[model samples]
Target: MTDHIDGALALSWMNTFTEDFHAAQQALTDLDRQAGDGDFGTNIASALRKVVAELPTADDATFASVFTATANGFLATGGTSGPLFGMWFRAVSRSTATEGTDTDLLAQGVAAGLAKVQTLGGASVGDNTMIDALAPASQALLDASTGGLTVDKALTSAARAARAGAASTADLLAARGRASYVGDLALGVEDPGAVTVAIFFEAGAAALSA
Candidate 1:
């Protein structure tokens, strides 16, 4: 099994994420409609498309390069969640900051991304934000790294954690982000940002496992 993620793998992960996101776009939009401004799906879809278009060729790819491109794509998008996701990806790219990245390195990048998001957004685990999924996924990656697992297994575990976190958001009252504006109206709906985080880790797992 592979122990590291390179540019090619990173690109594949993003492509997988894009495909999955496209499939779930309407569902995500519906969720956002019940909570926020209802543009989460469309905005994020545009960002991912831009990221895919700007991705480096596999021959010239590196973990940092791909993630940096992703960060820039999201940063270019207009909205509170978009730029927050941009900064999170920015931190992940900085943590890699090199031509290659191992599972442990990727875990560090995820952790850094989580920290960057929380610090910038002022939302903790139960804030009904992306951080809900990101925080648990980061911890799962850290645990997997400590267990010395392969990249696929590590990412799979992180994906599971993120999914659970996203699911938890449905039962939570919004404490931050656009959902907060809706009050109890968002109670039964999952946070789109958190679900996106789950989709991200699931894509990473699928890419690495394949």
Candidate 2:
């Protein structure tokens, strides 16, 4: 089993993940500007930049501590996505602090984060929200683990699921958040939140695999 992940590697992954999130946010901004706020990209990027900057540097820093710092950092940035993303990170911190680079711990942390998103967002699968991407990714990670997949493989599976889920949102009707206000106008457009969630999984997987 891959244990004892280096702190510098973890930090590098976080930085890379932040960059991926900015790219995804830009895509969402392009997609949503047709009917919703054009600021989604800026908002997410701003929040993630703060997350990256605030990450703890100590080799002994626990996953929970890092996650908590990420959450607190993002929360301070202020946005609709801020509290939500912060909550997810908070869940990750709580679930994975003791396990470090352990694959099982990472999977469990992601599942916990997904559950928190659902609870906080009150949006289920196919809701045309971040949950759309998050739910599928979490399930995929869990399934892959049960099948004896490696951590890197499981992360890849989750990233694929997240992308598929985000793409599926293009056919879904809006049911929550600002997109809901547009109703039918929301159809045929990819959800910004879903896309960003996919990016999150992709970044996380890359970090762990590296």
Candidate 3:
């Protein structure tokens, strides 16, 4: 119920994300094969594994430092997702750093990350992309923070929204990213990116609540 997400919580979040990525790797690969290239699972998994391995050893070990390292590491990757997600991590790092120890830090970080993703990806709420999950979860976190909800409650609410958003993509045609090429073929298949974001929120909530 603490408002602060200190360095410990930040490291814990990354660990949870890494574990979640590992758990979902196969499912994400399978989902990607249904509509786009099948490498989403492997690529994202490898990137997160790198983050887990490298970020925690920084001299400061602050929340900002860990997330900043994550951003910098992923920025080195090739292709669209790498740079975009790298920017997403950067936004989160900057937002939290700017907010200092405020109770709303996590919400601000998530919202900032989602904004960067929207800007870079040029995708909207129902685009059958990660934005589907990210947008809702960001809003939920913002709402919870504004309403003075505890960290656990806010993250849990955000996780629920993210999962719902990801599931809703199953019936929508792909309106963005490589999946867009599949057109109707993407229908009935949940977007891999959206599912990944769902995993992220779910892990964050679990880590904070635990």
Q: What is the TM-score of each candidate against the true structure?
A: 0.96, 0.88, 0.92
Candidate 1 lDDT for residue 96: 67
Question: What ranking emerges by lDDT with the best candidate at the front?
Answer: 1, 3, 2
The local distance difference test score of model 3 is 0.81
Superposition TM-score, candidate 2 onto the true structure: 0.88
> Model-by-model lDDT, in order?
0.90, 0.76, 0.81
Kindly list the per-residue Cα lDDT of model 2 for residues 120-192, writing each as its tens digit. Answer: 8899987788888988988897897688777667777999999999999999888888888888888899988
What is model 2's C-alpha RMSD?
2.2
lDDT of 2 at 117: 77
Q: Candidate 3 versus the native: TM-score?
A: 0.92
Can you give the lDDT of residue 35 in candidate 2? 44
Worst 10 residues of 1 by lDDT: 94-103
Residue-level lDDT for 175 in candidate 2: 81
True lDDT of residue 95, candidate 3: 58
Question: Tens digits of per-residue lDDT for model 3 on 1-210?
Answer: 756666777778778888878887898899999999888887786677667666865345777887887887677766667677889888878756533333487788888888888887899998898899999999998999889988778888988999999999998888888889989988899988888888877887787878
Best by TM-score: 1
TM-score of 1: 0.96
RMSD of each: 1.2, 2.2, 1.9
